[model samples]
Target: MALPDMDTSVGHSFGLEVDGIQIKQISEVSGLKMEQDVIELKQNTADGKYVIKKLPGRPKAGEVTFTRGLTSDNSFEKWIKDCHFGKMSDARKGGAVIVYDFEGNPIKRYKLTNAWAKSLEISTLKAGDTSVLTEKLVVTYEQMEAE
Candidate 1:
């Protein structure tokens, strides 16, 4: 998939009071394939200091399914509580990098992380298939946790 223009906001995340503690969704004008990695770049304008915030790659297609609403079934909720959260937090360094997408939601208590990648709409959705994009990308975090 080719990169999409720098749209500061590509998707959104939400935290609930039920099994689905946190959720993020990026609309695909094209299609969202699995196994592709997404990165959130944090560049400091003051000194050009930047950090890469990468989310775990999408599980191979068919390994997981996307649903209409947030639920325990969501993979993010199942992997956010691990050390990866700390890693992502550390990457941000001096600022308050808490998950803001789920703004005002108490479920944010679980060290959450969500951000948009440059854009990969031109990419195709393929399962069990690998692409060069996966290499440029890395699984910076494990997964988000579920309530």
Candidate 2:
């Protein structure tokens, strides 16, 4: 019998999309973390020893951060303004972060429910530097689902 060939392809981190928008020149994406609380209970037993019990609590998702070079478009800034100052109802929007493979195929996606921009930072400017302007966006979401 012949052995089946295994796929040795690796996924690349070249492109990502948020809310159906193509983000240009993404430097890095971090903060995909989840944590849970541990609860301990102590009880007295007939064996003259204390019995310790461990319980697991709810899990929490951490804030996700996306860093990229600043672009000419002001859509991100407008989105921030709409989230905080827009007169329209239901300003918050849910988005998805789709990661692509080396061949530009979709590998994984994280759906962010009720996501809003928690913070936005612009890179500092200098008089005699040749660095590209960059922006950092931190988003907070109610829940995240991996698909």
For each candidate, give its TM-score against the true structure: 0.16, 0.77
Question: Per-residue CA lDDT of candidate 1, range 12-93, in tens?
Answer: 4432222232333422112222245666665666668666666665543211122333223433332333324455432321
User: lDDT for each of the candidates?
Assistant: 0.30, 0.71
Off-target runs (Cα >4 Å) in candidate 1 are: 1-104, 112-122, 125-138, 142-147
User: Per-residue CA lDDT of candidate 2, range 44-103, in tens?
Assistant: 889889899999977675578888889886766776677678532444566777776556
Using lDDT as the measure, the top candidate is 2
Compared with the true structure, model 2 gives a TM-score of: 0.77
Best by TM-score: 2
In model 2, the Cα lDDT at residue 139 comes to: 78
* Candidate 2 lDDT trough over 10 residues, lowest sum: 1-10
Model 2 clashing residue pairs (backbone): none
